[model samples]
Target: MQALKGIAASNGIAIGKLKLCVKLDDKIAKKPITDVEAEIKRVESAKEEAEAALNRIYLDALKRVGEENSMIFQIHIMMLQDDDFFDAIKDCISDEKVNAEYAVWQAAQQFSTMFAQMDDEYMRARSADVVDISKRLLSCLDPNLDSGLDSLKEEAIVAASDLMPSETVQMDKSKVLAFVTEQGSKSSHSAILARTMSIPAVVGLCDAFSSLKDGAMTIVDGSAGDVIIEPDEATLKEYEQKRDAFLQHQKDLQLLKGTKAVTKSGVEMEINANIGHPSDVEMVLENDADGIGLFRSEFLYMESDDFPTEEQQFEAYKTVLEGMKGKRVIIRTLDLGADKQVPYLNIPKEENPAMGYRAIRISLDRKELFVTQLRALVRASAFGKLAIMFPMITSVEQVKEIKELLNQVKADLKAEGVAFAPDFEIGIMIETPASVILSDLLAKEVDFFSVGTNDLTQYTLAVDRMNPQISSMYDPRHPAVLRMIQMAAENAKKAGIWIGICGESAGDTELTRFYVDIGINELSVTPGTVLELRRTVQQLD
Candidate 1:
């Protein structure tokens, strides 16, 4: 057994023969392209293959997980079909006169590379998207090639250069457990998916691709972020026992499916769903979620053309709130900008779209944009319990400004005598390091704080996710990030404000105990993880 250490992208444990899944990116990069037509053909072929593979993935997910679960593919589907992407590839082929494969890939690399080089790390990390597209092309061109994952019959560790959201989602969530990425990060979508799938995975293993050969005995610890190769008997036995214990614990915890999430000390911790659409509310109910902790209303903006009117917003909020009944709901207002290009919102093109107008900042700049949402939330609150929260807040003054606007919106609503929730709590997301450092000050002014760990970790570490070069450095367990979360939680506590986590870290089962230890008041997670998360928290006290 050969052992190689790299960054752990996803957290999960798997013991299986190494089913080497080499990324064909290097191969695509090496392929020679002589003309623009060849490049176009290659690009089109990749798109077609991506479509077919993605469709298979969707079908596979639906076949295994269910249709609703498969809807996650919508964006991936759109990416393959998006005219912007095609146009980019076309321009590359036409201008560069390269083979179709190289044209699409070269264009994608250039496009993502520009964003990846931005001063804002969060925006820069977006270059993985280009790699994602390139992977689709590679996967498409090599139609007859084996998935590599399919050949593994016995329990074995899986190896890949890195994983994509679509590829990971299509992965057999059960049989081949755990992740070992030669390249990637803990913040990658692969990591997020591993957590969601409850599979232990480790990423950023630098030599995982070049070192580990097929059929190697691999051992990994999802919790400690440890992996051992050619483990001696003791190591193998220890992991086996640990794996079994975890499996049993999982069975026992599911019994808490409908039970209230209380610590052993009997403190109630709100276990809610972090959802994107009103339609997902039923999923919350089905999964027995306590309520909506992070209701991302951004989906409404993403799906609509024009700014969603107060009525449109009200109807959507009503559906979500109505579904949750009297349960508490914390709704995050529209978060859109260059990254989330909605046809309706005519947002200007920016070189660094991620750092450009986005999240609450955008809404605040365009008061009408935010006011419309505020009115809808107020109106919907009248019918159900609601807590409103802002996203991407980086300044204390922004909090105060929102308070003033809330007052004005309230006064306007009262003057109009519109039936609205008489009272609503206001909160802001702590996503930037600036906000994290000043969380105590901001906490005093807001009703609650939801740490957007996704952005927090990205901005804090300065790791551009799209550029796989430095992506290895981005880790949630990095002492610096842990300290930040600890400090923010402490400040929020000092300020006497309830604190919740809504980013990728919130729903993490392994991290639940860590959050509980650090004084997290609530955890807003995906609906599917609610039951397991409740169980994880139940163990804390």
Candidate 2:
């Protein structure tokens, strides 16, 4: 038996023979494409195969993960059918004089390079489609090349040197069990797809996975970050007992669903989810949350050439409100900067992007973009409960500017005879130290406050989030972070404004009593966390 510790990406357990997914390194092909028309025909055939594979996964996934979510394959479909993609192939086949398969694959390689350099996460995911298309093209061009998918016939744990999102789409449903990837992380598309499929997964185990030969007896406990290869009798028995206990625990968690978030004394505490997309409405509804507390609206802006218009914003917000059936949905205006630079805005390169122009700073500078989102939020308000919050508010001046813009938006709507909620609550995320320390005065002006502990801790500690050297210092449990959160809550309590916690600390059960003790009423977290939070709140006296 061998043990290796790594960042636990997903939580689950599995015991099956390991199935390794080898990532072929990008290298020059032996038999390259040499004809132009032949390359086009070859590309067409590869795409057809990819489309069929995608359809197969979509059909199988619809049985378990619903049609709405299993549609990640469509992203690949769009890539395969892209027009510019075919043009690039023509250029490559005509100029490069390579074999038809190699020509299309070469063109895809260029596209892959372009995607890999992009800063956005969703765009980065498209790199997988490029690789998938290329590999599929190469396989079709030469009938002799091996895809190594024959391993799926046996019941084994799926292992990959690196699995892209599209590659995992048509994964073996019954024969393949869990996933172990040398590349990617929890947030990576490969791991996310594995988790959604209810398959146990472990990533960042560079060379540890391959040490176990194919068909070797293995036990992968993703929850505890364990991988046992050739386990002894005692080890096998221990895991068997553990696996049985985990099954029962899952059953217990299922019972917690739909139960109102109440304390031991029946104190009805507000616990809501922080969603990123309109699709997350289903998650909140499924979790039976009190309402939507924080909707990180940055997602809409990231994948666009220009800012989202009022109509598009209104439609997205309307979907969420209708889905929640009149439940409260708080949407934060585009909170982006270095980590989330808007391609349209052209943010300058910064040594530390985390501290650079981000959140409210960018929105305030681009007032038109800010107003558009506000107008949408106001219009969405007529459909159901709605509240708007600003992010990265460091000074009272910033809040005043936002207030003025909100007023201007409301005035314009009224002037145009557009029906919208006349009066709406305006709040700011207390992310910076300046906001937290001066929460008392700021609380009087804003309707409410939400402490964003992730940034709060980073700024207080003066550590850049992306800098690996100082990553070990990012402890939300640090006394400084606790003090700021407590201070913000206390100040908000004194001023009689509703205070919330939307940061990762809000979901921490160990700090639940402490947060409640400090006078925080609303807790906003990921939807998957609501049940455990409800249990914790139930235990709170």
Task: Give the lDDT of residue 52 in candidate 2.
Answer: 79
What's every prediction's RMSD, in angstroms? Answer: 5.1, 5.9
TM-score of each: 0.77, 0.74
lDDT of 1 by residue, 326-412 (tens): 999898887776456665566776766666788877888899888988888888988788999988888888888988898898899
How accurate locally, in lDDT, is each candidate? 0.73, 0.73
In candidate 2 the C-alpha lDDT for residue 167 amounts to 57
Off by over 4 Å in 2: 1-4, 26-156, 162-176, 183-199, 232-234, 265-268, 302-306, 337-342, 346-352, 457-474
Q: Residue 363 of model 2: what lDDT?
A: 77
The TM-score measured for candidate 1 stands at 0.77
Error of 1 at 508 (Å): 6.5
Give the per-residue lDDT of model 2 (tens digit) for 1-541. 7765544555677776776554444433635544567666776776687677666665555444433234455455556678888788777777766666556666777898887666643455466568776665566566444355533677788776767665565566576667777756554556656655656777767667557566677788877667778788898898888878877776677688778777887667789987777766777888778998898786566545587788988998888877888778888888777445545677876655677687788778877777888888888888877888888887888888788888888888888988877666788899989999889989988889988887898788875333323444667889988998888988998999999998867887889988877878899987777877888898889
Q: Model 2: which residue pairs collide?
A: 21-159, 32-99, 33-98, 33-99, 33-100, 34-98, 34-99, 337-358
